[model samples]
Target: MAFERNTQETYYESIIRQGYSRRDFMKFSTYIAAYMGLETSAIGQVAKSLETTHRIPVIWEHYQECTCCSESFIRSDHPIVADIILDKISLDYTLTLMAASGHQAEAAKHATMEKYKGEYILCVEGSVPMGDDGNYCCIAGRSAKDLLIEAAEGAKAIIAWGSCACNGCVQAAYPNPTQATPIDKIIKNKPIIKVPGCPPIGEVMAGIIVHLITFDRLPELDNIGRPKAFYAKRVHDSCYRRPYYDAGLFAETFDDQNAKEGYCLYKVGCKGPMTYNSCGTIRWNNGVSFPIQSGHGCIGCSEEDFWDNGPFYERMTGLAGFGIESSADTIGKVAAGVLAGGLAAHAIAANISKRKELRDSIRTARENEKKFES
Candidate 1:
């Protein structure tokens, strides 16, 4: 099933054609607006854009990847979000989801590129292997590098879907035999948005797309080119066990009493303090639970070179700009020590006051006895 190009179709039109009512369209608009961090007043603007703006053509290309990004995307919390974005709208070419394959799939891709030149969105999901002249990954006799160059040549903007396409992921870790390279390193000319994660949350992906469609521009990005709305804070900043972290209550092991009590996982190599993502807030599996919530430490999958940063189960030391000397343990220990010292000091002061009062009472009693004798 090749997606037929309909240049005149708006997103709202596609939604209605897909059997959704106006109310459903509005609901989707509201839902996306909230996810995008838009104000209440902007809900109407988002809806208006979907109602008036023509669906932008999208060409999703996959190279050396596990296809987890696509898997996470299709399983978005809202069924309509997947339906409207992946199927009903302008997703003209995607090898994973499109029905057409081989030459038919290639043809649809080329058609959209030619028809929507400098107008279509290019979504690259995997890294390109620069080793062996790009022989590591190929599709239909074309090298991954060659495919990416051709597809990116005319794109309005490029969206690098996961860590693989953003920071080279595990493929680029260590010796990197394949020399897997992220898209931004290859295509420096185009504006690229890096949604870096092992597999980014489904709603975050949808929010990014809707943001692009609604505003006809890119969302406000962080210093590293991620959407600031979703990546503004570290996972530790929002984790439910943050109080435990601040209070020096840490789980020393995976099955310790502290772990069972829901203490902070920092001592056991939780990377939440260093990892900037919305996992704690947006969560996964339809906002049910993220990795930390499921009793595992954050691996900092979203940060650059996270795989090589350290061992997954070993705690990081001397993190800069975090707490005292950039160590959460240090902060917690110091806080605990200060509290204990204050209590001890208070106790000693009270004991001295009691002794002084006793002395004064005895002296008064002796004076009374002398007065009575006189």
Candidate 2:
């Protein structure tokens, strides 16, 4: 019943006509629900959302970026990302993958803008160069700024993909000549979800898209416009070597026994404590591995100004430690000392507590025997 959509095809009827079965649609909905951190009861909402809501047309604009966001998106562990999102979710214009290009492709994008008019979703990758009155980057003889505003005017929402689009990444670093600017700095009127990373986690990218498709709304964003569900905690909170961190064990340097034994990378400049992301859990390369798991410290790619955060190989110094939250410096020694103290205390306290219970039971038994003797 959702109108002759922008594409002139209704939501449910369009996918069916495109060769997707109802079962495929249901599976995609369920998967998206989980990715969006929805409850089991919400799958119904998710299903209805997809079934009733027309696929939001996306105008994927690329500028001063390497297109790694799209690469990571398509390589997600889940097929739904590439299959449903990239191939099916109404991506009308993209420079890298679109078969149409030159004057024809530009015309198609213009047609969608006029036809959809405040209905399509705008996804921007890379930063816009603003120096020299935005003349640094141009498309089809129009400044990037002009193109962005033109496309955004017709968009229902905007998604800023990767640090390039969110924070300008390395392009906006100090002494920038072109004055690279993030999307948020230019687009102030609409809601923007910033998924920042060198290349965002593939599944996380998929999750964001799916949340939009399944809920027709943005996911719960944190102060930074990142989804709280995925960026809620530091990677340190979930690292496997966290026990080593708490116990104060460190590798000191790479190739040491501790490093080989999978000790915490805190000593090797891991930014896990300061970085918030799903890198430790969702991982990368089809969930096969992440930097930390591969024995490298987190570079905090998801964070702002990470390029200036410090040298990636230099560990953080002078952190607070208490309540078993010690760093990698003294964990082994402290754990040994604590174990020794507990062992001595447990030995002395064990027999007396057991004997007191035994004494009470024997007294009760003796009284019962006296009663029987009488």
Candidate 3:
């Protein structure tokens, strides 16, 4: 019994120690399981894992990024997610959240790496600069590349937390000065899950970790290494304005009547058609609203190299299936223009036919009068 007492605490035990009831723990498990896209049957499995498995060691490393991933993560709507996953978990090292710094922080990282080698998860939140012998970015007098290589050497898997880590983001945009490179590029041997966005949604981030914790394995990934559960459907599939797009109705401009009436924003440079993210379904700021819901286009922040995709206000031109030289704006406008022209032509023809009938009747009346006079 003393040996059992010395055993590592499971996730449920940790939370319960923090004053959460068993009912609350079960509810929290069910909630996170749903977020992980697990069915009702799997909720029991998730709860069991949380109740039995010890906390996995996590090493969160920062490179060249805005720390928005951490910012977004801490704002998760689920208290259990923020507390259990982010706060109470065995997160041995993180530049942003850790209390220690300098020598103490480096020692903690090394200790965890040594103790949990090949068992810990390494979460990278930014790009690694290789230019100038990696002089562009440094931490504790070591190049970003050296730190990444050392950390990734013993990690069981790696999770790239944002666009900066997954696809180099704006730092790797055209004419990259620092030669910022994504995690996948720098570390190729290990399994890497890329949760890409300018900053991905908070719940989605939690769901990925919950999936890892519950299943003790990685979630099914897409070709680009993102979780299929969240990135499977394009934002266009679940967009509220999809029917308008199908019917060819679109806002011609941002301030137009169609825009005010909640028409599709495809014409106004919305990237929902090409962007694969859960923003439309999951929303943001605790489901308050996403960019599209807030009257702005998606800007395709989740896609790779979105910074170089061209002007945000100008829609993509020359789409293969669109049949127009420009984007949805041109197609919608051209279709509307054609419809208006057809209506005008039809009205003119109808009036012409009516006038001819009137003239024929008048002639017939005049002829009948002449016949009667004769």
The digit string of per-residue lDDT tens for model 1 on 78-182 reads 878889888667688998888789999998999889988999999999999999999999998999999999999999999999999999999999779999999
Candidate 3, run of 10 with poorest lDDT: 1-10
| Candidate with maximal lDDT | 1
Off by over 4 Å in 2: 1-24, 316-374
lDDT string, candidate 3, 1-374, tens digits: 11112228898888898888999888888877887788899989999988888888889999999999999999987788877778656577888887778888888889888878899899999999989999999999999999999999999999999999999999999788999999999898999999998899999999999889888999999998999999999999989888999999998899999999888999788999999999988889998999888888889988987887766776765454555346677788989999999999999998787998888999999999989954
Worst ten in a row by lDDT for model 1: 317-326
Considering only N, C-alpha and C atoms within 3 Å, which residue pairs clash in candidate 3? none
Better of 1 and 2 by TM-score: 1
lDDT score, candidate 1:
0.91
CA lDDT scores, all candidates in order = 0.91, 0.81, 0.87
Q: For candidate 1, what is the TM-score?
A: 0.84
Error of 2 at 118 (Å): 1.3
Q: Which candidate is the best by TM-score?
A: 1
What TM-score does prediction 2 earn?
A: 0.79
